[model samples]
Target: MRILIVTNYYEPEEGAAAVIITRLARYLARQGHQVTVLTSAPNYPHGRIHDRYRGRFSLSETRNGVRIISTWLWATPSPRISRKFLSQITFMLTAALRGLTLPRPDVMLVEAAPIFTNLAGVFLSFVKRVPYVLDVHDLWPDHMLTVGAMTERHPAYRAARWLVDHTYRRAAQIIALTPYLEQVIRGYIPGMDKVRTVYSGVDLERFRPGLDDAAFRAKHALGNARIVAYIGTLGTAYDCLTMLETAFHLRDRRDILFVIMGTGTQQQVVRDRLAQGDLPNVRWIEWVKYTEIPQAWAATSIAFWALFNHPLHRGAVGTKMYEALASGVPIAVALEGVVADILRESGAGVSVPFGSVDALSAAIRRLLDDPAYYARCSQNARAYAEQHFDAEKAAQTYEAALLKAA
Candidate 1:
């Protein structure tokens, strides 16, 4: 089988979609399928193309038997609506043009976010007469509204909805990252028997228990303090301000240390708060290599996942939570819906109401102060990861779905 994956981001870029798509492409190639990825030059989170990929219209590379073709797109650091829309539109046009030159595949699997990328896949599928699968990572228009980027009555929102509905109806299959998202898709295109919920799993080999905790702690000079970590993009969707408030609430506790390890548009806001000299117990580290994530997990006692309360977020299931489980660390999440339900079902962590700094601080304290409960949660975390979130198993499921769509 020949599989063509269309996405906005790919390897050397650090994000959940990049990791998932790379893993899937590699796994499918390992299974004797010809896999190729069509993506934009690596410029995400920071919004500037990497030095190596700059000034190039298109470039191609291969990694582990998978072909990667990167096309050009506008780069801007501003999170303004116009800049973001321009970036998406440029990628959509370039990717569609590039797709026309490629060999027609048995199936086309596309990462649908920013929504506009789906246009490339739809156009290619129509021209080539190949079945296309819409792999939805996030629901747009709704997400834009949640972040105050647009309103329901806005012309842009209405146009996005029309485009999304058209794509959903035309897709041969829809791959949703969470059950809630699957439900939402089904609601949009009712009686579509093709939607499936496929959770993004973690790499068990790379992110299991028993890392060099001592070395990590020593390197960071975290002397005998309990570490609670929030390790991912610090973007608008996340309530990072609440995390800062939680840090302030626990600032007097010398034994508790808060570590935030990522960068995004909201970085300056957090930096300003830290500069106020009120969060001495808090520490911020810029993004690290993906390989070094295990070390970060090793130094953590509790993993924190925070998101702003929004209806759009109800369907979100962050990759960080699965990574934390794979690392045998308990979770402390401040969000509702799928993630909270997972904690409740697996007994692997505790959850609190979103935006409640007091509750967030209290949850961290409970995990730190209660050894017996902590041990149980830690054990459950690893067990859950092994049973439910293995990458190879997810790849197999995806392979079957793609084959069926083809």
Candidate 2:
């Protein structure tokens, strides 16, 4: 099968979509499918074009086996309402125009975040006459509004709705990471027979306790304390400040440390919070290579999957959750939603209801102080990672989605 994946986030860029697409493309390519990724020069959460691809219109390259076509898109220094919408528009146009000339794809897998990517899917469904699938990463305007990135009744919302509705109406099939997003789509678009849910998969084999390296930890000085980490985007949707508050609340436990790793739009604000007080227990790690994640694991005692409590978060799944489990470290997730349900079902971690500083602190303390419960959580974490979150499962689910769409 020849597949074309259009998304704003991809390799050299970092985010949930980037990781998801990269893994899927590689996995599919290995299975003898031809994959073409139509994306922009790597500029993401930081809002700056990569130093290497700067000032270029588009560049085509191959990573692993997938053909990557990088194109022009809006680059912003910060996440402003006007700039984000423009960026999505830029991506949709350039990617669509580029994919038009390429060989006819058997399936068009368009990621809906930029919302413009769906424009390409909208065209491919009607123009190229390919069976396009819109992977609903978020509910678009609704999510943007939730994050305060945009207004609910704004013109852009209506425009995005129109484009998405067109694709939803036209596409052969639909995939959503969470049920919450699926319901959101059905509410607006009506017909829902084509939609399906496939939670994101983690490479449990790569993300496990055995990978921990002492040399890497010593280099980063990770040897000094018990680390509780929040890894992934610092975007508005992630309530990492709450993790900081948890750290501050336990300041008396000097042995406990909070390590924040990853990049995003809210980085400056995070820095401000770090500088405002004297919490030496906190360490802000910029971006770390995925290959070096074992270092992160070696250094941390607990992993915090902190997300902003929102309706969208209920069905959302990110790799960080499984990664924490794979590392044999207990998870402390404070953002209430579907995640809590999964955690409770698996007994993999403790859940602190969202926005409750006291609950978050108590959960952290419970994991830290109780040996048997903490060990059970840790063991359950690893067991869950192996049983449910491996990349093999992810690849299989992705393959099934395409085959089913066909």
Candidate 3:
């Protein structure tokens, strides 16, 4: 099969979407399918185009046997809503135009976030008379509303809902990242037999135990300090402030350190709060390359995951959780819904109520204090990751769906 993947982000972007997309594209290509990706130049989280990709309207390259077509986008460092919306719109228009110039594929796999990319997929599918599979990483409009980015009365909200429903109806198949999201999609497009749940699996080869933790610790000069790390986009949906509060609560315990590594709109917010309060127990690092993530994980005793307390986030699962599990590092997540369920079922870590600093702090302290429990959770974490979140298995699932859709 000749497969074309359309997404707003791709390789070198250092996000879940980029990782998943790149993995699937390579997997499909290796499976003897001709896979192509249409995406914007690498500019995400930080929002500045990579130096190598800058000043290009469009470019194409082949990586790991897959063809990549990157187009220019309106880049901005600020994570403001207006700037993000403009970036998405620009990518949508340019990607669509680029799609028109490409050879028609057997199937088109569209990443649905920034939502407008699906519009381009729908158009291309119709024009080329090929089936398109909609891979929904998150539910738009609803997510926007949940994040307070849009209200019901907002014209954009109504328009987004309409666009989402239209795209769902037209899609040959819908891929939901979680079971709860599959249910939500079913509700939106009732009796839709095409929706399937394909989780964002972790790269087991890239994230595993036995890395040089001592070297990582020595490199950071984090002598004897137990590091609790949060590595991902510091976006609006995440409650970094709550993490800071937890840090403040545990400041008296000199052994515990909170390390936040990522860049987003909330990065400055975290910086400002830390500066004003002079929180010595916390450390902030800018985004690291994807290749360096395993070292970061090695430096962590506990993986900290926090999401804002919102219904929209209930169905979502962070890709970092699986990465932590794969690394044999226990997780301390502050969120509810499927992620919480996973922790409980897998016994890989502890889950605290979202935004509860007391609960989060206590959970962290408990794990650190109880060596036996920490060891058990760490062992369970790797086991659970291998059994449930293996990247090879996920790639096969995606391949089957794309083939069936085509």
lDDT of 3 by residue, 217-270 (tens): 676677778899998888778888888888888888888788998877788779
Predicted candidate 3, C-alpha RMSD: 1.3
| C-alpha lDDT of candidate 2 relative to the true structure | 0.78
Backbone clashes for every candidate come to 0, 0, 0
lDDT of 2 by residue, 161-267 (tens): 77668778776778877777778788887757888777776776667776656776676676768888887777677776777788888889977878889877778
Q: What TM-score does candidate 1 get on C-alpha atoms?
A: 0.97
For all predicted structures, in order, the TM-scores are 0.97, 0.94, 0.97
Candidate 1 lDDT tens digits, 1-406: 9999999878988787788889889999999999999999999878999998899988999989999999999988886878888998999999999989999999999888878788888889999999988998899767888878778899988998988888899888888899998898888878888898888799998898888878767766777778889888887788888888988888888888999989887898888888899788998887767777888898889998678888778678888899999999999888888989989988999888888888888998888889999999999999998999998998898899888999
Report the error of model 3 at residue 102, Å: 0.8
C-alpha RMSD values across all candidates? 1.3, 1.9, 1.3
- Once superposed on the true structure, which residue ranges of model 3 sit more than 4 Å away at CA? none
Off by over 4 Å in 1: none
